[model samples]
Every structure is written in structure tokens, then in C-alpha cells.
Target: MTRCRLCGSAALVSVVDLGATPPCESFLAADQLDEPEPAYPLHLRVCTDCWLAQIPPLITPEETFTQYAYFSSYSTSWVEHARTFVADAVQRVGLGPDAFVVEVASNDGYLLKHVVDRGIRCLGIEPSVNVGAAARDAGVPTLTAFLDPATGSDVRAEHGPADLVVANNVYAHIPDVVGFTRGLRALVADDGWVSIEVQHLLTLIEENQYDTIYHEHFQYYTVASATRALAAGGLALVDVELLPTHGGSIRLWARPAEAAGEPSRGVADVLAREKAAGLQELSGYTEFSARVAKVRRDLLRFLIEVAERGETVVGYGAPGKGNTLLNHCGIRPDLLPYTVDRNPYKHGRFTPGTRIPILPPEQIAADRPDYVLVLPWNLRAELVEQLSFVHDWGGRLVFPIPELSIVEVAS
Candidate 1:
């Protein structure tokens, strides 16, 4: 039995079993295709003790991140999201040129570049060599190492405790939630805050966001579980904000527990909301696997129906979430054919387990497939706007998760 990573509770209830899957981010080179790829059980369990939903750590961080294929700058929408956050953070935190900012898992400096542009002292901790080098080239000082107490202390000693430590969307990727929160506590000044954004577990279950679960992501959090994990590291959750990014996420602002301050009403409101949603009970999680199974069946039926009619179907965005969906559903290139992506690094490569060819976006126009399966369904609006040219050939777009449906573009 796998103990809960946060509370060490052996009483774990199964949420959803995605079967065996390779590392979602492991996009393959043509040369490596002939070699056999290994896969591990992509199972999820919720802790009855802390209500933390997590996957077992079957792979190391080095295997997933050291030479990572993902770069944050590739997503324009995400960059703009970062820009907006930095601007808000500067004003809200009363940041000035003298203030120090540190972003953990700061992929490719997409966010930190804006910090530098503002003339504030900034540093980035990114584990991926490829993305870290890109961050440096973009003028953000970066250290390519995993964030832990030792690394955090070294950074604190050199740069002094940060006024604002940004850890957006990276908190879920960590396996040692306690150690990571401790690192956050160590890196921030007494008066400073550590801002963490993670996909809300309520949103994941309610919205059927199973695709977001991959080997790289270790845990999904509710405000309650996050509060417990933070408290263990002497950090206090002072505020919380719900964000639309990643389907639905909560941006938590925390400070050292030794600091004096009352948590904002937002924190209490969210905790109450989670309770109302039945997150505090195991029955709330029992039905999720049924919903996930239905989605898999529905997606397969859609693809098979399209193929039987002798129509073509391709995909857009070769994201890690997309890979999870494809591999879990057993959809291979023969059924969906090739997919397109904006990241040139992924071009000409194949997805990890399914081996779907990742091509340039131009492929969509060339083949003009009857249906384009949008893998990153969260960006459905932006992608629909960008790929509106599909209408020229009467080609339509489809999303598999949350339900299989054709997109209705505004005229």
C-alpha cells in the first residue's frame, strides 16, 4: 500500500486508475522509436486523513525534468498570464527595485523576463537544463537545480530572503510536499509571501479533468490539504484566489506561521466551498472513476465513428496532458493520425506512449482533416480563435475530455 505523500497515511482510497503510461513529457526522437519504452501504473489515490489526491512516485525528477522538453515561453497565453500576475504582484506586494523575486520551476524565463524588464532583482530555479539555458539566454539568472532546503538556503544566503517567491503550477509537480513547503518557508523573508498555484481537486473531479494527471504531476490539492501541508513546514495560508488557468486553479498566498496576520476571508470561503463540495468525505471521490470510464468510452466511440465513415481526424497541441488522454484511451496514430504543435522542439517527434507524430501547425492546413482533436481542451477558446481557418475546408474541431463534442465557432 502506498502511503500518502503528505500525511503518511496508509489509508488511501482509489480515485481513478489510468492504467500504465510512460512519462507524458517524454517526446521521442526518431532514432529512439525502435527502442522499447517503459510505462508505469498511472493510478491516483486520495488520503482519507488529509484529503490529498496523489499519484505514487514511480519516476524520479531527473527522469522527467533534467533534460525536459517543455518550455513555458511556447505558450503565448501562459506568458501573458505571467505578465499580468507580475504586474499585480508588484503593486500588491509593494515591490520596488530593491525587492528580490524568486520563481521556482521558472521554465524558460517566460515570467522572470518581465520581472527583469521592471528593473527588480530576480532569480529563477529551474531543473530542466534545456529550459534553464533558455532562461539564461533570455537574461534571467537561473540555477538549474531542484528546490530543497539546502538549495533554498544557498539561494537565501546569496540573494537574501526573497520579498516574493512565485511557485505557480509547480507545487503539484513536487513529491515531497513537506520538504518543498519548508524550502519555500526558508526562501521568503519574514514579511514576504510565497505564492503557489495548483489545480484545485474540486475542479479536477467536478470538471472531469483526468487528463491533467501525468507521471510528472505527483499530487492534486484542495485548500484543506494544502493548508495541512503548509502548516507542517511552518507556513500559514493567508489568502487564496481562484484562477481559470489549468481548467481551474487556486493561487495561495502564504507567510511564515511566526508572522502576525489574519488569513483573508478568501481563504475561509474556499475552505467552506471545498467542504460543501464533499471533498472532506470519501464518497465525493468514489464516483469520479465512473465518470472517467465514460469519457474514455465516449472518446473511443467518437474516433471509431469518424474512422468508419472514412473521415480523417488529427490533433492540435502535443501537451503532456494530451498524451495522458491519448494513451489512456488507447488512441494511436492510425486512428487520430498526426498532431500539430507550436513548439518547434516537439516538431517531428512522437508522443511518449501513443507515438502520435508531432508536426507543425501547418499540417492542419495541408491535410485539412475532417476533424481536429484539440488535446489541450483548457485552451479551447484560444485555439478555436487561432485555428478558425479550419472552417475554410469545412473541418471542425473536437475536444475529448469533460465530454466529446464538436466546437461551435462564433461566426
Candidate 2:
């Protein structure tokens, strides 16, 4: 039985089955043309007792994240996002020259750069060689290893406990939930705080975001389930804040068990909402698998109908979520001629499993396809604005999941 990673509950039900898929980030090199790619079961389940949503176990972190190709500095919006986060966190946490801040999975020191400018000491724990080297180049002291208990102890022994630990969008990627949280407890100072951002499960279900499933992301977290996992590792949830980044996410502020403070109203409000919505009930999960199946049918029907009409359809954003959606819906190059990506690294490559070609955004303007499928629907507003020139050709943008709709751009 595939039990819950945190609570080990056997009362688990399959929520969404995305079929077999390779790790979304594992883009192939041109030279290795004949190299076989391995695909694993992309099935998701929800634990009734803990309400933790997770995928079936397959690959380990060491196999997935080492020498990673992604760099946080690639996105202009993301860089600005990091800058704002650093400024707000430094002020809100009251961090200064004497205080130390530690960031886990701190890819390329995206957030630490602003902290360093303020003359505050900051340490980054990054597993990817390319990203770690970038951080080091930026003069940010970074340890090139996964944040586990032993590494946490080593960091504390050398630099002492940190005043603030920032773990942005990493809580969902960890397979060893217990060990990772315990490491946080080991590294945080008595009065220090740990701020973590995770994509909320409630938003995922409500918005029909089944595309977020992939091997690299092991778990989908709700605030209630996260609290259970963290408290199990001797941490207390002090506050929660909703953010518009990454579709929809919840930023949680927690401290070691000894720190006493009134819990934020957002925390209790979300917890009660989840319970009232039947997140704690098994039937809530059992019904979700059916919804996922409907999404697959609807998307495939829409794509095939568009293709049959002899209308050209191309995809936008070669994101990880897009990979899952494309592969699961059995969409091949025959349906989506090619996809566009802002990341230079992915532009020339093909998406994993689906093998759909990726091109630059300029290709979209050049081709002027009849319909442009916005795969990363979360960023539709931003993307539509950037690609507004499609209006000149009378091209309409199509969003598949949550619902299939076309929005005509103003000419």
C-alpha cells in the first residue's frame, strides 16, 4: 500500500492519474538522440487522515536535482518577485547586520542578492551545481548539498543557528517530509522563524490544476496538512498569507515549538474552510479522480476538434505543468505543432514524453497560428499582453483546463 509520506495513513485514495511521464525538467540534449528516456507512473493520491496529496514514489532527489538546468534569473518577472520578497522579508523579519538568514533550495541566490546588499549575512543551501556556482559567483556563501539533518547540523556547527530560514516553493518537492522538517528545527534559532511557500491544494482542486503533477514534485500541500507535518517535526505554525505567485500559493511563517504567539487568523480560517469542504473526508478524494478523467476528455476533444477544422494550434510556455498536461492528454506534435518558451535553454529542445518541439516566442508572431493554446494558464494575463500582436492576424488565445475558452485580443 502506498501510505501517506507524513502520517503513514493507509486510508488513501487515488485522486488523479496522469499516466506515465518523464521528469518534466529532464530536457534531452541533441547529441543523445537515441538515448532512451524513462517514464514513471504519474499517479496522485490523497491521504484521508492527513489530507496530504502526493504522487506514487519513483525517483529520488539525488537523481533529479543535481546539476539542474533551471536558473531563477531567467524570468524577468521572477527576478522582480525575488527582489520584492527580499525587501519585504528583511523589513518584516527585522533582519540586520548581526542576524543571519538561511535559504534552502536557494537557486542562483535569487533572493539572497538583495539580503547581501543590505549588509546582512546570508547562507544558501542549494543542491544543483550550476545554480550553486551562480550563487557563489554572486558572492553568496552556498553549500552544494540537499538540506538534510546531517547537513543542517554541520551548517549550525560552523555558522550557528539562523535568525530566518527561507524555503520558497520547496515544501512540495521534498519526498522525505519528516526529515526535511526536522532539519529545519535543527537549523533554526530558538526565536527564529521559517517561512515556506507552497502551492495550496485547495486552489489546485478548485481551479482544476491537475497539470501540476510530475515526478519532481512529490507532494501537494494544504495549510492544514502542512501544519500536521511541521508540528510532527517540532514546529508551530504562527501565520499564513496568500500570494498570487505560481497560480496560487500560501506563505507560512512558523517557529520552533518554544516560541509562543497567537496564530494568524488566516491559519484558523483556512483550516476550518478545508474541514468544512470535506478535505478531511475520504469521499472528497475518491470523487476527484473522476474529475481528472473528465478534464482529459474535454482537453483532447477540444484539441482534436480544432485540428480537424484545419485550424493551426500552437502552445505557449513549455513549463513543467504544461509537460504533464500535454503528455497526459496524449497531445503530440500532430495536435500542437510546437510550443514556445521564454527560457533559452528549452527553446531548441523538445518536451519530454510528448516530444513536441519548442520554439522562441518570435515563432508565434511569425507563424500567426489560428489559435494559440496557453498551457500555463496561470500566467495567461501576462502572456496575452506580451503576445497582443496576435490580434493583427485575428488569432484568439485558447485556455484548456478549468474550462476551454477563447479570448479575442483587441486589435
Maximum-lDDT candidate: 1
Candidate 2, residues 99-178, lDDT tens digits: the string is 99999999999889888989999899999988899999999889999988888889999999999999997888889998
What C-alpha lDDT do the candidate models reach, one value each? 0.92, 0.85
Q: List where candidate 1 sits over 4 angstroms from the true fold.
A: none
The runs of at least 3 residues in candidate 2 whose Cα sits more than 4 Å from the true structure, single-residue gaps closed, are: none
- Candidate number achieving the greatest TM-score relative to the actual structure: 1
Clashes of 2: 0
Q: TM-score of predicted model 1? A: 0.98
List of clashing residue pairs for candidate 2: none
Instruction: Kindly give the stretch of ten consecutive residues in candidate 2 with the minimal lDDT sum.
Output: 282-291
How far is each candidate from the true structure, as Cα RMSD in Å?
Answer: 1.0, 1.8
